[model samples]
Target: MVKVQQSKFVASAKKLTQCPPEDIAEIAFLGRSNVGKSTFINLLSNHFKLAKSSSTPGKTQLINFFESIWIFKEEQYKMRFVDLPGFGYAKVAKTLKEEWKKDLWEFLNCRSTIKLFIHLVDSRHTQLEIDLQVSQMLEKLCRGDQSVLKIYTKCDKLNSNQRALLSKQGLLLSTNQNLIKSQHGGVETIRLEILKKVFGYEG
Candidate 1:
């Protein structure tokens, strides 16, 4: 069975300067507030509190980090998860919101350890303008080594035809359901894809 052998909060930072200087592989989780990013991370790690979830959106202002080790059969891999602050709809003062965006942009474009960007979008609201902006920003800022994965959250709410359409669109979609049988084990599939990106496909 695939399991999170070790998962712990590492640190929280407001900017790249304040972040840990480790050069290890990192996966960045970013999305609009209330998009289930924290819950998705929890499901992936099998540690519910590894990333904090808030009833009110935009509660996570700082960039939170988590170090985790995963064991699947005989293979083990270590990596960091960077939970970026939610943007766009945050109910912050306009002045402070600008500053937050500045810090977030700097972190996203300058963080060298980030091997992949997991951009979570709510499946029900797939046409949101904010998500498109974030997707554009990721594509524009991504380097040769970094790739972006857009996983749609709450996919179990979608019907089979909608899910099939999303699949046909060539988008990497996933659900936050903890069940291994849900949506063909979507969460586990995402975990394995993340592991492959971090450690290569040798295992």
Candidate 2:
């Protein structure tokens, strides 16, 4: 099984200008606060504390990076997981919120090393405006050069049948319906296909 050989905190970015310069290929995880972005990163990397997770919304106030070195077939390659701060918290000041948006936009638009953007969404709530905005931002950034994958988080909360149904319905309603249909079926199936198409692997 693929495993994260090393995962350590790299840096934090309150402003995109403050982000570190790196040439490594990067994949980012973004979602509204309390949507499980941190948990998802931890689960994928097989490191519980790799990304700080919390039930409290808006816990992450800055961009957190985890330097992940994956080991497979006795070869090693470095990967970066960017945990972007969750937006849409009602208690945040308007000025701070705007700064956060600007920071996110700069990182997504200016970071040349970013190879993939993983848009995470809560499986139970499919119609969040903030999530849609994030998706659109990634789409624009892709500019036909790269790709973005939408991941419906918290799938373990659903039974197999419920998961399948949700995936089917999500595919049917998405703009990329054909792409979803070409997969085994539904959102989870489509998610796997998207990952392969975008990142050149199922991971």
Candidate 3:
């Protein structure tokens, strides 16, 4: 059986060279700012504060590496969750914002350790231009060895019909306990998908 044993914050990187030694496969999360990337990561790791969220959007300025351990067939394997800086709607200046866009493209297009891209889109607004563009980009950039998993965040706000329709597009998630189950998706599903993708373990 495959089980995501645990996950922890390893380090933060401002640029590609500053990232820790790329020794293991990585599943990077990419999403627009305020899309609840941090909350999703925290839910998966079962560490509420594993990734910090700010009242102001786009506070995640660095690529955060969260190391996760997997137990399968009585053996342990490792993987990393690369939290790339959120794109769009940041409170930063124009030049810095433009710089961030370049950095993100470089990291995504050139990061060799990346085996999968977890693209999170807000459930309420699935057709945002930036999200659509990013989705297309990831599809183009994906290689034979890589895959893209698009997930919808904050699905609790969606009505029943909306959630049902969204379930067909991809995964739907909400960190809010009172409304998480409404989406019919949760942390375990996300964990299993990551394990299957990066470690080739389905259980």
lDDT of 1 by residue, 65-164 (tens): 9988988877778899999888666787889988988998888878888999998888799889999998888899989888888887777777877876
Off by over 4 Å in 1: 170-185
Number of backbone clashes in candidate 1: 0
lDDT of 3 by residue, 73-109 (tens): 7878788889988878788789988887788788888
> Please, what is the whole-model Cα lDDT of each candidate in the order they appear?
0.80, 0.68, 0.84
Off by over 4 Å in 3: 1-4, 72-75, 176-183
All predictions: root-mean-square deviation over Cα?
Answer: 2.2, 6.1, 2.1
Best by lDDT: 3
TM-score of each: 0.90, 0.79, 0.90
- State candidate 3's TM-score: 0.90
In angstroms, give how far residue 154 of model 2 lies from its true place: 1.4
Ranked by TM-score, the better of candidates 1 and 2 is 1
C-alpha displacement of 56 in model 2, angstroms?
A: 4.1
Candidate 2, residues 1-203: lDDT per residue as tens digits? 45458788889888777777866778877787787777667756667878886556775687888887766556576778888887666377789777777777887888887777777787777788888777777776785556677777665565557667777544221224453355334444443443465457645
**Candidate 2: pairs in clash:** 167-186, 167-187
Instruction: Pick the winner on lDDT between candidates 1 and 2.
Output: 1
